[model samples]
Target: MTWDAVIVGSGFGGAMVAHRLISAGARVLMIERGDWVTRGEAAWRPEASFELTPSYARDIPYRCDRGGHGTTIGAVACVGGPSVYYGCVSFRFRELDFVGDADVVADSGAAWPYRYDEIEPFYGEAEGLLGISGDDAGDPTAPRRSRPFPFPPGELAPISMRVVETAVDMGLSPFHLPLAINHTASAARQKCVACRTCDTYACAIEAKNDVATMMIRPLVERGMTLWTNTVALRLEAEGTAVRRLVVHRRDSGEELAVEAERFVLAAGALGSPHLVLASKLDELSPARAAVGRYLMRHDNAMIFGVFPQRPDPTRRFHKQVALHDWYFGDPGAAEGAHLTKLGGVQQMMTPPKELVRAHLPLGTKTLLGGFTEQLTGLLCIAEDQPRKDNGVSVDWSIRDGYGLPQLVIDTSYTARDDLAVDVLARRARQILSNMGALLSYTHRVKTFSHAVGTLRMGTDPETSPLDGDCRFRGVENLWITDGSALPMSAGVNPSLTIAANALRAAAAMVAR
Candidate 1:
C-alpha cells in the first residue's frame, strides 16, 4: 500500500517523525537498514560488542590526512541506531551555535541559514518527549529552557561528586550531567538500573530510553509498520520528487519497490548522502556541489584523572558530573592564563574491566586494572568546526558485500579544529590538576559518534542541500531530519539537536 510518508532509519530523527506523523493520523511506514539489537545478557557483553555481536555496525574504512591516522569508523546500524547505546548526554546547543561563528564562517564560508530562536521551542518539546532529566544550574551558558527537564536530576557517585567539588572550588561551573533516562514514576519509563554498561553497551533490561525501547514500539502499536533488516538501495526519483524506493531485504536478499507520496530521509549524515549520491540526485540538484559537503564531527578526547581514593566498582552510576565553564572561546584574561572557547566537558562511566582488557596491552592493562578503582574520566565534546572539504562520498573504487560502492568518509580537519582540541584537552588537564589528581592524560580521536552536516539545512540552494524545514532543496517530497541537517555541530552532543529539528520537520510534514 502506498503510505502518506515513508521514513527511513529508525534512529532519533526517524523515530520522532514516525511518532508525530502517526499521531497526526497519517499512514506512515518506516524502513530500517539494521534489525533490532540484543535484548538480554548479550547487551552487557563489552568485549564482543563490536568484535562478535551482529550489531550490524558499518565498518567503513576512513583516513585522516594530516595526523596520518586511519581506521574503520564503526557507526552502529541497528534499528535504533547509536541512540540505543549512547551516554545519554542530551544538551541543547548554545544560541550562538545556531547563529554561526563569525570567525569560522568567514574562513570556511559555512553558516546556518536559520538561528536558535526558530528552533528553541522544538528543543523543549524534544526534551519533554524523551524524558530528559538534569540540573541546569551549573551551566550558565546553556540556552534558556522553555520548561524544566521532564524528571529530577540523577544522583552522582562519590568519585564523580568528589571531582565536582574540586571543580567548583576551582571556580568552574559543574553540575549533574543531563541524561535521557526514566528517573521518576511520573515519566513512565522502564526502571533504570543505572549500570556501568550504558555508554557504549545496549540496555540489558530495555530501560535506557533509546528510540527502539521508548518510541518505536509505541508507534508500531499505533499503526506504524516498521520494516527492519531492510537496506535502502536507491531511490526512484522523478523530475522533482521521490517516486518510490528500491530496497533490498537482508534476510532473504529479495528486492522490493515501495511507493510513498512523501519521504523523510533520516538515514544519518553518512548514510543519507550515500542514498542521494547513489540516486544520482547530485546530477539533478541545483546544490550538487554541496550534497555531501561541510561535514563536522567534534574532535573528542577523554581525560582520565587518577585520584588516591578507590571508587566502588559495584556501584553503577559514575557519569554524573558535568562542567560547561567554557562554552565559547575564553575572552582576554591574564597573559599567562590559558584560553578556551572550544567545547563542553562531562563525566563518563569508568571503563569496565571487560572493555579495558580487550583494548589495552597486557602489561598496561594489568597495571591499569590494579588501579581501576582510582581512575575517573572526563569527556571533551569539542566543537570541531565545519569545513566544506570534509565529507562523505561514494567510493566507486571499492564495493561492499551488498555490491555497492562502500561509503567513504574523508575527514581532513582544519587547523582551527586542532586548536579547539588542544585548548579543550589542556583545560581538562588543568581541572584535574586543581582537583589534586595524581596524574591526568588525554586520548584524542575523530569519533564517528557525533558527526553532523553533509545534507545541511539552509535557505540558499547553492550552499545547502536542504531548506530550513529539512526538505531537500530541489526535491518536493524529500525531507531529512538527522545530523545531516545540522549546518554546524556545537560543543554539545548532536542527538538532541537532531531530534528537535526532526520534531519541527514532522510538524511541517503533517501541516501539508
Candidate 2:
C-alpha cells in the first residue's frame, strides 16, 4: 500500500508526524527499529535495572576516523525512542538560538533559516501534547508564550527548595524547570508518582509523557500502522522522489518493500546520517558535503553536591528548579572572556553507582560511601559549538551483527564549548558553595541522547542538507524531522525542539 507518509523512526519527530498526518485523513506507516518498550511495575521500582536492560538499549560501534578511536554507542532502541528514558526536562530554545546571532551560529554554515516566533506555536502545541508542567513566567530565558502550559507547575522538593533559596540569596533568578511528566490529573495521562527511577528508567504507569503514550497511542485507532521491531534498510528513490522504503522485519527476519507518497527520516542524528550514506543517497544530494556533517553534542555534565544534611529521597521530584543566570554569563566571571551566558542549571537525580563509578574521580569514589545520603546531583547543559569535521561516517570495514555498516561518530567540541562548560561548572560550584556544601565536583559525559546537527537546516543548500521547512534540498518528497534537522546547538535539551520542528515539517507536507 502506498500510504500518505512513511516515518522511519517512532521517536518524537516520527510520532508527531504520524499522528498529525493520520489525523488529517491520510494513511501513515510508522516504522520503528526497536521492539515495543514493555512497561510494568519493574519500571517503577526505584532499585530496578530496567533502563540498561538489553531490550531498552542497543550498543553499536562508534569509531573516530581521525584518530582510529572507538567506543560503544549505547542508544535507546524502543518504539518511543530516548523520550522514554530521558529526565523529562521540557525546554524551548532561547530566542537568540534562532535569531542568527553569532553566539549560536557555527562557522561550517550553521544558522537557522527561520526565527523563534515562527516556531513558537508549535512549541506551545508540543508542550500541551507532552503535558509539560511548569510556571510559564518562571523561566527568565523562556520565549514569549502564546498561551500557558496545559498543566500548572508542581511544588518544589526539599533539595530544590534549598537550591532555589541559595540561588536567590546569591541574587540569581531560580525558577521551576519545565518538565514533560504529568504532575496532576489532567486531560493527559496519569499523574507522576514522583519515583526516583524517572530519569534513566521508563515510566511504568504512563506518567512520563513519551510520544508513544501521548501522541501515537491515541492515533492507533484512527488508522496508523505501528510496526515495531522493524529496521529500515534504505530508501529507493526514483529521480527526485522516494519510490519506496526497503526494510528488514526483525521479528520475522524478512525483507520487504513499503511504498508511500512521501517519506520522513526521523531515525535520530546518527541513525539518519548512517541510513542516508549507507543507502548511497549522498550520490544524489546537491550538496553531498553537507549530507553527513556538522555533528554536535551539547557540552553536558553532572555536578554532585554534598550538603551538611541528607537530602530527602521521597521528595516529589528532584529536578524542580532551574537557573538561567549563567545561561548568558554571570558578571562575576572574569572580564574580556568570550564566555556569554553559558547553558542551563537544574536539579539532577543520583545516578546508579555502577554507571557513575568510572566517571567519578578516584579520590571522590573512595569518599562516596559516607556522603551518599548527603549527595545530590545538579545537571548542567551547555551549547556545543558545531564543528564541520566532527560528524558521522559509515565505517566500511566494520559491520554490526545485523550485517549493516557500523556508524563512526567522529565528534568533539570546540574551545568555545569548553568556555561554556567552564562557566557552567563555575556557576554550579558557586551555588553549591554558597549553601555550605561539603564537596562539589563536576563530571562531564556525552552520549547519543543529546546528538544533533548531523543533517542541519539552513538558508543555503550548499551548506545544509535540509531547507528551512526541513525538506531535503534535492529530494522533494523527503523530509528530515529529527534532532538532526536543528542547525544550532542550544543550551537546553533538544526534545521539545525536535517535536516542534516535526510539527512544522508535518504541516508543510500536509499543505502540499
Candidate 3:
C-alpha cells in the first residue's frame, strides 16, 4: 500500500505532521525505531530511568568526540521520543530569537527564513494540542500571545515557592514554567499526581501529555498506520523525488521497502543527517556543504544549592519557576562580551538518591546518600551559536546490529558558548545563595537533549539545505519538519518550537 505520507520518526515533528495529515483524510504511516513504553509500577521506579535501564535505549551508540575526549552514548529511543522523558517545559521562542546575531551570522550561516509572527497561530495550536498549562504573567521576554494557554497552571509546591520568593526578593521576576502535563481532572485523561519521578521517568498513569499520549495515540485511532520497532535504513530516490524508504523490522527481522507519495524526515538532528548522508542524498542537494553543518545544542549546566536543612522534606514536585532577567543579555555585563544573547534559568529538582550514590566515592557513598534531601538545583540554558566545523558524520568501519554504519558526532563548545553558560551559572548560584544556601556547586550537562540546526532552512539555497517552507532544496516530495530544520536555537526549551514548525510545514505540504 502506498501511503499518502510516510513519516520517518514519531516525535514532535513526525507526530504533529501525522496528526495534521491524518485528520485531513490522508493515509499516513508513522515509523518509530523504538517500541511503546510499558507504563506500570516499573515506570515510576528508580531502576527504570534513562541511565539505569536499557528498555527504551537506542541499540546503536553514537560515537562522540568533545572536550578532547571520546565517548559513546545511546539516545533515548521510544515511540514518543525524548518528549516522554522531558521535563515538559513548553516555551515559544522570543520574537527576537528569530533574528540572528550579527556575529553568529558571520561565523555561521544562521538565519531564520520567516519571522515569529508567521508561526504564532501554529504555536497556539500546538499548545492546545499538548494541553499546556501556565501563566506567563511574569515572563517579560515572552512573545505576544494570540490566546491564553489551554489550562491554567496548578498550585505551586512548597519547595517551588521558596525559589519564587527568593527570586522576587532579588528583584527578579520569575514565573511558572509552561508545562505540558494533564493537570485538570477529567474522565478523558488522568491528572498529574505531582510526583518527584517526573523529568526522567515516564508517567505510569499517563498523566504527562507527551507525543505518544496526546498525538500518536489519537493519530492511530484516526486510521494512521503506526509502526514501532521499525528502523528506517535510507531513502531511495530516483531523479528529483524519493521513490521509497527501506526499513528493517526488528520483530520480524525482515527488510522491506515502503512507498509513499510524500516523505517527511523527522528522525531528529543526528538521526536525520545520518540517514541522509548514508543514502548519499547530499549529492543531490544544492547546498551540499550545508547538508550536515552548523550543529547547535544550547550550552547547559546544573547549579546545586547545598543547604543546612532538607529543602524538600517530603520531596514533592518542584520543577517550576523560570528566570528570564538575563535572557536577552546581562544588564551589568561589559560591552563586547559573550553575556550578550544569554539564556534563561529554571528551577530543577534534586537528583534521586541512587543517582547521587552512583558517582560518589565508595567510602563516602553511603554517608553522602542522605545529603540528597538537602539539595535543590537550578538549570542554566545558555544560547549557543552554530559553527561550521561541528556536525555529524557516519563511520563506515563500525556497524550496528542492523548492519548500518554507526553515527559519528564531532561537536564542541566555543569560548563564547562557555562564557555565556558561565554567566547564567553565576546568576543561578546567586539565586540559590539568596535562599539561605550554605554553598553551591556546578555540574555541566553533556547531553544532546536540545539538538538542532543540521539541515537548516533559509532563504539562500547556497547556505541552507532546506527551503523557506522546509522542503529539501532539490527533492520535490521531501520535507524536513524536525528540529534539524531550525536555523537558530533560542534560550528556552525547543520542544514547542519544533511542534509549531511541524504544524506549519504540514499545512504547506498539504497545500502543495
Candidate 4:
C-alpha cells in the first residue's frame, strides 16, 4: 500500500509531522524501530523490577557496540522514542541562537534559513499541544506567548528551594521551569506523583507528556498507521524524487518495501544521517556534501554542592525554577548567558551512596550527617560548537539484526566546546557559593541527551544536506524534521525547537 507520507521515526519530530499531516487529510505511515509500551506498562517500579537491570531501562534502546569513543550513548527503540524517557524540560532557542558567529557555523555552513520570529507561533502551538506547565510572567527572557501555560507551575521540592534562594541571593532571576507534563489529574492521564526516578527512568504515572501520550496515541486514534519494531534500511529514488523505502522487522527480520509520495526522516541526529549515508545516497546526491559533517551535542555538566544540614532530597524534589541571568549575557547584547529554573536543579540529585561518597571524603558517616540539610545544585548545559571532526558515519562492515549497516558515531568535544562547558561550570559553582551552600563536588563535563547538527539546514545546498525548508538538497518529496536539521547546537534543550520546526516544515510541505 502506498502512503501520502512515510515518517522514519516516531519521536517528537516525526510525531509532530504525522499529527499535522494526518489532520490535513494526508495518510501517514510512521515506522518506528522499537516496541510500543502502553501507559500501564511503560515503566517498572523498583518493587516490580530490580533497579539497574536491563529490563528496568525502559523507553531507551540498548547500544550493541562501544567503539574507541568511551561513551555509552543509547537511543530509544520505542514508539515515542527518547521523548518517552526525557526530563520533559521543553524550551525554545533564544533569538541569537538562530544567527550566531560561532566558528562551527562558519566552518560547517550558513545560519538557519528561518529566524526566531518565523517559528515563534509554532513554538506556542507546540507548547499547547504538549500541555506545558509554567508561569511565563516569571521568566523575562521567555519568548512572548499568545496564551498562558495550560497548568500552574509544579511546586518546589525542599532541595530546589535552597538552590532558588542561593540563585536569588546571587542576583539571578529564577523562574518556574516549563515542563511538558500533564499537571492535572485528568481522565486520560494521571497527575505527576513526584517520582524521583526521572531522567533515565520512564514516568509510570503518564504525567510526563511524552510523544506517545500526547501526540501518537491521539493521532493513532484518528486513524494514523503506526508500524512499531520496523526499521527502514534505505530509500529508493527516481530522478529527483523518493519513490519507496526498504524496511525490515527489527525482531522477525521480515522484509517489506513501502512506497510513499513524500518521505520524512526523523530518525534523530545520529540515526538519520547514518541511514542516508548507508543508502549510498551520497553518490546519488553528492552536492549535499555536509550530510554527516558538522555534528554537535550540548556539552553539559552537573554541579553538586552539599550543605551542613540534612536536606530531605525526597522524590518530591522540585523540578521547576530556572535561572536565565546567564542564558544571554548583557541586555541589548545579541547573546546573553542564562540558566533554567532552580527547582529543576534538584533533578540532578546524586544517588544516595554516590552522593555520600562524593561529599564525605573524610568518611561516609560525616556525609550522612550533612545529608539532613538541603544540598543545593544546578546543571550547566552550554552550547557546543559544531565540529567536522565529530560526526556520524556509516560503518557498512558492521551490520545490525536486519543486515543494514550500523551507525558509527565518532563524536568528541572541541577545545572551544570544552571551554564553554568549563565557563558554565565555574559560573554555577560561584552562584551556589554565593547562596551559602558549602561546595561539595562538581561532576565532570558530560554530554546532555540533546544532540543535533549532523545534517544541518542552510540556504546553500552545496554546504548543507537540507535546505531552509528541511527538504534534502536535490531530492524533492524528501525532508528531515528532527534535531539533525539543526544548524547550531543551542544551549537550551532541543525538544521544543524540534517540534516547532517540524510544524513549520509540515506547513511548508502542505503549501507545496
- Flag the better candidate by TM-score, 1 or 4: 1
Give me the overall lDDT of model 3. Answer: 0.87
Q: Cα RMSD to native, each candidate? A: 2.5, 2.3, 1.8, 4.7
Summarize candidate 3's per-residue lDDT along 333-448 as a digit string, tens digits. 54325455888999897878887687555775786666788889999998888888888888889999877788888888888888888888888888899998899867787778
Tens digits of per-residue lDDT for model 4, 1-512: 88999999999889989988998999999998777654454363433222343322333322323322234455556778888767788877777677764453546555789888999889988988898887857565677666677777888886677667877776767787778877688677688877665554567777888888889989999989998878788898888788999998757767889999999999988778877887777665545567787777777777766655544436464556676665544232222223221111223543344333433436554654345345645777767677666777776676765666766666667665665566666667776677566765665543325778888888776777888888888788889999999988777778999999999999899889
Q: Which ten residues in a row have the lowest lDDT in candidate 2?
A: 61-70
1 against 3, candidate with superior TM-score: 3
What's model 2's overall lDDT? 0.80
lDDT by residue for model 1 over 256-365, one digit each (tens)? 99999999888888789988887887777788899888888887888877778755445677778778776676553323124344778888778776676555556677
lDDT of each: 0.78, 0.80, 0.87, 0.72
Candidate 2 lDDT tens digits, 1-512: 68888899888989888867987899888898887677889775544444456554454555555422136655677878878878898899988878644764646678888888999999998988888988847567878889987887777777778888998898888998889888777674578877767887888888888877887678777888889888888899888888999998978989999999889999999889888888778877777898778888788878887777766565446878888877776567773156664789888876555545544567767667446667777788988877788888887788876666887777776777777887777778888888778878777766657888899998887888898888988888899899999887788899999999999888888888
Better of 3 and 4 by TM-score: 3
User: TM-scores for all candidates?
Assistant: 0.93, 0.94, 0.97, 0.87
**332, model 1: CA deviation in Å?**
7.0
Give the per-residue Cα lDDT of candidate 3 at 136: 96
| Model 1 regions more than 4 Å off | 48-52, 58-69, 185-189, 312-314, 332-340, 357-370
Which of 1 and 2 is ahead in lDDT?
Answer: 2
Question: What would you estimate as the lDDT of candidate 4?
Answer: 0.72
Off by over 4 Å in 2: 45-51, 64-70, 103-106, 186-189, 313-316, 358-366
